[model samples]
Target: MTLVAFRYWLAGMSLALATLVTPLSTAQAISPLGGPRFAAVLMDADTNEILYAEQATAIRHPASITKVMTLYIVFDALDAGRLRLDDRVVMTPRAVSQRPSKLGIGVGQSLSVEEAISVVAVKSANDVAVALAEKVGGSEENFARLMTAKARQLGMRQTVFANASGLPDPAHFTSAQDIAILSAAMIRHHPDRYRCFSEQSYSYGRLRLANHNKLLGVVPGLDGIKTGFTNDSGFTLTASAIRGGRRLIAVVLGSPSGWQRDRDITTLLNTGFTALDIRRNGGIEDMPALLSSAGFTLNRSLRPVPQLATLDVEEGDGE
Candidate 1:
């Protein structure tokens, strides 16, 4: 069968198998946060088919993962000739005053649009994020409105953007499914620009900043994406990988720690790829069995609940 035909068939089969699996109950749906604060989704990026989900639609804080949408808007501006890579983005006092995990660019100092993108993608620079927002939307407040509009346009019904850098706000929120949709949109709409997410480190003058997503090089087939954390959001990640031309997007939100978050997403992607292979070779019946098996379950008992003090300061730096 042709590749397109095969993908369509596979999507149908996966959806059918999804119907057979029982949804997790409120008690069983608990996140590593010791509550129902977590949500996860694994999707076949190429087909946009959901392979597995746990409270995927639950609302949760997005933290610095909000930068993905920030960059998306920047990319759109670049594409429309409204912005240029070489154009300078000046740091306003407001941008410079943003919290830690920032570029530390001073007021009146400036960086090129391209440099701003790299800083935001690799370092999760909150200051640069605000600069980019202001550059694109005149003000961060207006930029957030634009972000919400774009999210709606992208069909992210549960997502609402409140800031450019994803600082804590009771108003800001998104879901695992919505984040998966955003990740897929980034891959689908801005394949070239998406490379920024894979950058391990970025340098400016005397300072060198590293990317927070640690699994980029360690996990085979894994590539560019983003990570986030906050007192309200916990640890969140949206990752994408490709193997044998098949790509998958996995999102894990509100984990207790970065270690558990990374580990959970890794497991999700690995299981997702294995399930795809089983569906492709062994048949659709084998796929569901694999996902439902005891071996595929995430071990939540071992996760340690972090201190409230730590969560207050752990936004974009650690992962």
Candidate 2:
């Protein structure tokens, strides 16, 4: 090659190397751990640094993941003295219309706020979500406005909600990053209610249900948040775990099957938790490329980053 051509190539190579070596905070440097083909994100529940992501902001219907927002507003009401666990909530016809993954609540049936929460958190109950939404905002439509307003306040720019039940509204959408941010908020803003995520099962009346969040019993210190599924959105999960004093939140959306979604989430948790100081094995022997190196490390802080970048990119542009 000519001297000029060689020098130009060398300069370009050097520039690329420098870019790779530039210092970055934990949130900015780490890429998504596994290359799943849909929206995903993992962040420090404490530091709010994104540890991993793939299409984190790709907006899609959240299915029951909508309940996370429902729980958020419910938590707010509890905080403001508008509601309480022991307070009774009467089911309305509108709440009964929500689709399945429900408590099968009858019209006029009443449950304490705490009882309703258990049914929704563990069972992913559509009926219960509507009831909570109504109790807080006087109607599901009004509560939805509250949910959207809260989303904007939390910087979930890619998210919009139409109902608390999270039924298949193409109009109701959110990103994995937004859900992670919401999950972290629920944990910090309402510890008492967030603990409900860790419970494996609950029974009300004649019905009993296991928590849809598969990681609850199997994953160490994984509790808080929810799971979701639908024909269009595939299978989805939002998971959180704390290990060695560091808390991490992970969200996976649009997996092809419920079992596969559970498996993918399990892999991420295994890597981010056990591999904190070394290499994250992700508990699988053959998928080394899917797992992260064991050496990633960061400090544990009680505070999450409060000011987030405006998540303006929508479904098409996000990731």
Q: Pick the candidate with the highest lDDT.
A: 1
Q: What's model 1's TM-score?
A: 0.84
For 200-280, candidate 2 gives per-residue lDDT tens digits of 889887777888776776778787578876654556789888887888888887665566667767777776654455544
Quick one: best TM-score, which candidate?
1
Residue 94 displacement (Å), model 1: 0.9
TM-score of each: 0.84, 0.75
Q: In terms of TM-score, how similar is model 2 to the real structure?
A: 0.75
What tens digits encode model 1's per-residue C-alpha lDDT throughout 102-195? 8786899999999999999998989999999999887897777777767777878777677899887656677889999999999999999999
Question: Model 1 segments beyond 4 Å from truth?
Answer: 1-36, 285-319
Candidate 2 regions exceeding 4 Å error are: 1-37, 279-319
